[model samples]
Target: MKRTFTEGLGRKELAEIKACTQCRECLRYCPVQEVTGRVEISPSEKIRIYRDFIERTESLRALITGRDIPEQLLKDFTRAVFECTTCGVCGEVCPAGIDTQRLWPLLRREMVKRGLGPVGGQAEMPEVIRNTGNPYNQPPSERYRPWFPDETEIAEKAEVAYYVGCTGAYQAQPMVRGDVLILKAIGIEFTMLKEEEEVCCGFPLFITGQHELLEGLVKRLVDAYKNKGVKELVCSCPCCVNMMAKDWPFYYGKELPFKIVHVTQYALKAIKTGKLRIDHGLEERLIYHDPCYLSRGVGVIKEPRDVLRSIPGVELIEFDRWGRLSRCCGAGGAARKVFHDNAVAIARLSIDEACHRGADRLVLSCPACYEKVNDAMKDYPKKVRIVDIMELLSEIIYGQNA
Candidate 1:
């Protein structure tokens, strides 16, 4: 059964759609617009297109004549929404305070149910996760054992549990490895799920708007942690953390048994408690790239910078658009899989800015940004060292290259 244009949207979303003034202020900050220069795909244009569809489908004329929206118009809207990184900058800049990040996915969810979306390679994610327990379709056995630090001990059950999100476990191993190394260095007793016991957190599916599997996946993961007696859950991936904190309960139908905190937030707490020490220092200038999900999705804007600043003899550089207004690294919204060229192009914008700012290292916290920005670093005329905050800290403290 196909839903009407206005279905699935709540009062807030409806008012947001109705509130779009088409002021176009968000266009200047949109990374997609900055790179593609396609006004048709701009945020304001997307809202306009959706709003028009709602009016057309609901109008009295449509009921009398059995009118239908044009196929090309729907196709254009689908492409426009999926092409976005869902970075939420549009929402941050919206004069009417429309939450475009949240709105875009709801819009995409409607389209997905109508057999009209999850554009390009994104449509394959749900099936891939189902078959292999991850969006990357990699074997589950290879998730953590390959990179587990031998000397570190994982408690059989602990109050704190670390979630090695799919991206960090499979793609950016060094980042999660550093996470464990830091945990052990702080002497924090933490537990982890067995390699095969952990599954996708459903962020890929959620962001792409293929949400049928989200509830099952969320329940399974949440129950696993609950059985472990986990009081707090720590994750390095912002996408996973945001999903757990914001949407997991909606699916679980109650408050979660545990709290979810980012690795940076956890590490900062350790530092403040004197459980973790920044014993080593790097004498170099560094710029931190705030991952969109971490900075905006969860309002974790201060912890990462505070962690970076704690190290001795390090100068931190800020991107002109930092914190809530940070630019997307282009890998978000599942866009990188389909818009490979655009993903790299948008990532280069950040790298270019980092290099031009004369930073020796460009530090990142999210695995998605870590992977995509590193890919963008290749074949570029200039280079800035890309390192995850965990990796950088592990190297600084342990005196070994992470």
Candidate 2:
């Protein structure tokens, strides 16, 4: 079965769609096409389809003004759109300076308005997020208990708040716990929004075109944070950071009261301030995987590596694609939930790249990347130990406490 989007092709989008230069640089960096070798998933091809559609629509404007839109064009366009991970890597490489990352979500909004959106496993996301306040639909009580024990000294109100997003709370509990332990050992003043009070940042919803749900979720979340008196928010998830720093103000129709900072930023400061001293040393060779949302979305290319280098005896290496050219872990735009095999395949490319570089350990900042890359490396011949930066940092600071 195929779906088509026939609504909400705004004039601005139509005009910008004409600017594609056809240089195909975006296709060179697309994780989907790189892993799957499907030209249908090429970012260049996607733009070409949209361009051709606009050209045909303009030529037949008068005749089809009150008639049906082109169904075949819409079908082809929708398929190409969803095939993307929306990692923003394409936009970084686009010669025309087109923002394909933004374009994809806008197109998804059109797809949803016309009932062609959120195909496959993503169809049930709204209900899950609505009922559970999380896309995973896990019980709220089960969320924080795994990582945030009752004995942990989390204040009800504090100047700094640590937000462990859905992925950190549910999928990577150990990573979150390790981060908290390190924070505790370092004696930093911080608070946590109990899992009950925290909800999905709606990055998944926003990227998948569930605007109504996203708007409501944002209001509730921002309102909670505003009432909580948190002056600064530190996070361990890139998707949550991107949603808060990039989308929240626009979605809330006002500026946020607190500033958003990823945990790597916090970690870097802790290292410099002598709060998180590397009391112990671990000698290892590791490569850092820059989460797409962090590097391109938030423009944080060096903080994680800086944190790594600050530690003793840690050799921070890079793969062929690093910094601005860092590859995706195949987990953006909620693509993993919808395109599991393809997502793992994209992740395998990076895993192989890291292993081939002779990196015995792979350090990552995003929980989504951690989960996806770990899964992808299960059957891989190379035994690269995948660990989150926070977890590895804990080993050097808190030792057994992590």
Candidate 3:
């Protein structure tokens, strides 16, 4: 017999659903709730409806016949779940200590199993990734050829390899270019998979609750890196790094052969050890916006800040809520594809805050944040330039447009 939807939800998750206090604490912290002003989409309400589903499924009547959750209820629940940015802020603020970031995806996984989830353009992710090795469905040949830094060299086999995730490869090319430029300047020998070999890191698929291709994607990436003698995998995107560091082992069936390190973590060591130097000075006030996966998800709150503080003639500032309490870029959890207006509005919250604080530039580390916030900047009259930290560092070190 096939496994039931409730069967896929482990004991811990079921316990979490029951654990929600309905105290309305998470509602204020939820980005989707804040943006949409929709009470139904609040974290607490999601827990309530899902718990109701579990109850109906396990009832004596349901056991004898079948679970009979209302179609309208399911539709409402799906909207609420998919609309969430899954930024983990609610989880951070939860008095009940529920890990909503992890829990939300499990809920989404069950929804996908039932064929009722992943609204709008998000539904196209799995097929696109399988067909073109990326969610954008762009030609694989265009991944690196258009934007790879000319000065950087890719070794045939090396201990360190850089994974340019789909977003950086396609949407935010300059950020990855800066990543390679800094790596080259630091004299860190690194290798890269051939354009076609470096497929999506499976973050989009995983976050959207599509997992059928995950094991295959994970295995393929691991084997490719292992065959290339990669011992440390370096990446710029926090989502990719988080997925590799946290989830890849489960799919690989063991610890991965290589270690996963975010580029900021890698760069910080170089700065302290005198391997990398910032000789140029920039006299400007800048605020570093923390990426959700990098900060809260992986406990990487300090490294990026430490790096920014090291630059000469630079004054570092903070948002009112930063670090673990940082606001979501609103591009997370694949919500931006379907909830674009909300995504842009949520992103504007970050920009509006930065400009209000008199920041000259809003330095970001995540490509998703970079892309969405850049889009948000277009319409806002009160403007601040958005830049990736890597891109800023490259400009300082190698001159303009470097």
Candidate 4:
């Protein structure tokens, strides 16, 4: 329903902006600032710039007077805004309750409208999504091939549909296999859209201010799932779950036909009800890395940890920045794809944290975290075992054959 930057910037946002004490609490929690060590990218800094711009533009009646803002202003605004991962840590720590998480994207959307943004590596994303069903720009057939169990049965028309996100299909194919295995093992009937028929859930597009193409992309997905009589929409990726559960309804101003449930939520219930059992649980000192989308985006902090703890003999520990304070793995918001080196630098911080904490393994639920962090740990083989939660479960259920 929030269609424009102006609508998002009205009274509530203004009050939050005006009330900022600039205690720098947000900086302490920001992963981008932590990685870059730049005051320019701090949430406080962005807030200050935005407020100054708003005051000047409004005072001069720039909207109606045909006044021109400086090009350098737009360039600086774009850099400060886009460089941030928008992990919602600012909202969590802000004393003034400023929703910088929402504000940043809205600001980015305004930048795009003014022809200022989708900076760095994100500029080509819209065209890529339009041409391909997913973001990796891989062919549809390549995405359709199953990477998990070859014998897993997927129902044709089930009340439950597994919305395997683009990350699951492409980047972390094994995680998709693991998620499907878990669903089947739990005696849940589910269906997945064929890759050719699959359209992205549009989190990448939405966060980067490509709203113009997002509505149609999401609506096509919603209508297809709705037509199939699916009542429960289950997702393995937190990014997709967050967008489908929050963004779709908020942006479209309509309730979804089916409910959105993260795969961990479903797996947690299965564990409690005795439907899901891990007979051969691995004994390892592991830590659960909370993906920003699930924890801060959709408030799914507990379920992932609970799922990990449910496995017998898994000694779970916490990262220095876990749960609400979790550091981004530097993959979300198209950061890894757009700003590759900087994104990896951000990811390295978490990898170093896991190493310092002496965790034998890092259990990640989000495909973004799994891919980004796993890639970061490629050379540091002795540091920690980075495995997706679903993949870990599949191993327990199916043994080495999995």
Candidate 5:
């Protein structure tokens, strides 16, 4: 059932778009709107434009008046449609209670019908997921690069298997290293899927509206895990954890044999039970940026902070906005690709808050947030360090050498 553009904007979507009275209240609260200051660029304004385009009579009249929409406008619309991080910040402050996040996806499905979807880096992501079982198009054998050869062998026979996502495997190498190190320090027996056996968790695909392809990927992943007789599925990527733990069952119509846990949660459990030990001290002030997926998406707020608090000599400072209400670093939903400037603006907003708090470092749990925030800080006046929770924990538990 390929969705058509008109089919995507059914009554529900149309009503949401139509319900917007152009109050401009959402405009004042929008992070992007604040930076850009373009009323037409605000989330509500964009939805109104989309609604007008859907209206046949208005679209034709605009075209006849030489105000016909241009290809770039369409492209811009397509980009803006999915550019939102879906952080719910807009809805949180929306006086009209309009759900822009939900509206954006429905709008995006129509854009996809027009061959305008999955913009920028996400353009080829669905195809990669369809073929490689992951978006990186890397062989499953690559998944084991994070583990020592000896540990790999041990993992094969272990009761729990740690799924190191693509970012953990390739981009954030330290995260993978830290996860293995912490697991080993805790003496937790876990196996790793050999490179050829690993698959992408299909979050990008699921979010991008390639919902039909999800079942096959989910089936393949669940089958592989079940065959290992693994009791737990631990991962460092919160997106992967959300996909495997929550989304997979929705697509596959069955609960996976293994339970899913983010590595942070596991680390917190180990620390509390005295299974893992930390001897390091942090004398500097630290502020935790709740990754949208980790805190708001899954509500795993306490564990990461708890782990931070367990460290000696570290002061955890709260921003005026924190926890589920925390602002986004602006890299999610392929926003960085489509609207790079807007994404950076959002990232800078978060960074400005961190600087205002007078913190020496910005601690994050999500790899996406870590990457975006680090990039955003490059132009800032202050020299604040951005660190992933795993990297910080590893430094504390394993020392500088580890």
Candidate 6:
């Protein structure tokens, strides 16, 4: 395979790919490969195909042959590439430390260049984000409503501020409600941005490779918090917290002035310190599915579990694959758009694991994971309930209090 088509590799990208020793040690641990059992679709194989495209210019003949690659082929490739739940398991298992987690996105950028990128629902997000600053394409005014109905007041200069990411604003409305209930239950003093001043967290932009737009949005968010004297930031979305905590500092020259905490961590703190009293006695065999952005991206496996454990009579059964090694639900990196089947396949694997463990309910933290995995379980044997952890907490608290 005279491998000679490296056109997209700049000095940095070339150095990274060249560093690969072609050690297949990572193959043993990749969940996708483990599920599919095909080397051609493995991360290493994907990279090899990329290298061949870069090194062997002759491979361009595939495109030049004037034979249209079936939309399904492109869709499958995009799904396979982006389907990585970003578990970082392969990186932990790799002897050479190839860092496929980072490499996958770079490869996706190249894939997008060939118009073979994420399909279906995700296909429209990049354009929506670029145009309206949010993936849902709703008016920004629709974004600024207080997460709670009427109890909390917008402060002029609060010590803490809540950064409701896009999912919090739109998809995961219950999470927003849960957050408001917890804050109100504890009497924590925080102010939310007026509806007109709130902005998207730009996570959709970053994942879609809209770097320029992302940078601008990050600046806008950082400045908004800084100007408002927000010393702490509370977020309900793990993706938003991960980006603000890690990627923002890396991409921007400065660290954000405000500290970031996911709703789980904040809720746990309140419960532990007696700020909030949650009534226990929810008897259910619950399995917690760690969202990739929270567990692997931010090392937050225990906090969510700790909260679940606090509920009296709540039995938290550990899945065979969990924490940093959690299997993806097939929605991350726009995989739901590119590879709908692969996403469903991955979600099916997770559902089976939960069922095998005898879980009556599946608790998730990410809105995307909740939606994708829930959809996958439609044809599942048992009726497994998919719910956000916050939703469960709200139910437990309200049920007990009421």
lDDT tens digits by residue: candidate 4, 189-291: 8887777878888888888987878888888888788888899999989889988988888665699888999999999999999999877777888888899
Instruction: Give the Å shift of residue 29 in candidate 3.
Output: 1.0
The 10 consecutive residues of candidate 3 with the worst lDDT sum are 1-10
**What would the per-residue lDDT of candidate 3 be over residues 213-264, giving only the tens digit for each residue?**
9999999999999999999999999999989999999988999999999999
Instruction: Return the top candidate by lDDT.
Output: 1
Error of 2 at 30 (Å): 1.0
Q: After superposition, how far is residue 129 of candidate 3 from its true place, in Å?
A: 0.8
TM-score of each: 0.98, 0.93, 0.97, 0.94, 0.84, 0.84
lDDT of 1 by residue, 1-402 (tens): 546888879999999999999999999999998899999999999999888888778777567766588898988899889999999999998999999878999999988988899888788888999898999999999999889888788899999999999999999999999999998888989999988889999888988889999999999999999999999999999999999999999988899999999999999999999999998788999999999999889999999999999999999999999999999999999899898888999999999999999999999999999999989888989788899998899899888755
Estimate candidate 5's alpha-carbon lDDT, on a 0 to 1 scale.
0.74
CA lDDT scores, all candidates in order: 0.92, 0.81, 0.90, 0.82, 0.74, 0.72
- For model 1, the superposed segments whose C-alpha errors exceed 4 Å read 61-66
Clashes of 1: 0
Give the Å shift of residue 273 in candidate 1. 1.0
Query: TM-score for model 3?
Result: 0.97
TM-score-superior candidate, 2 or 5: 2
lDDT of 2 by residue, 12-82 (tens): 56655777777887778888888788787688788777666544444565355633457876776776687
Model 6 residue runs over 4 Å out of place are 1-16, 19-25, 28-31, 34-38, 53-87, 111-124, 144-147, 400-402
Candidate 1 accuracy as TM-score? 0.98
lDDT of residue 120 for candidate 5: 74
lDDT of 6 by residue, 48-160 (tens): 65565544344456566643345665566665666654545666566666666556766666666666764456567767776666788877777756445564566777777
Candidates in descending TM-score order? 1, 3, 4, 2, 5, 6
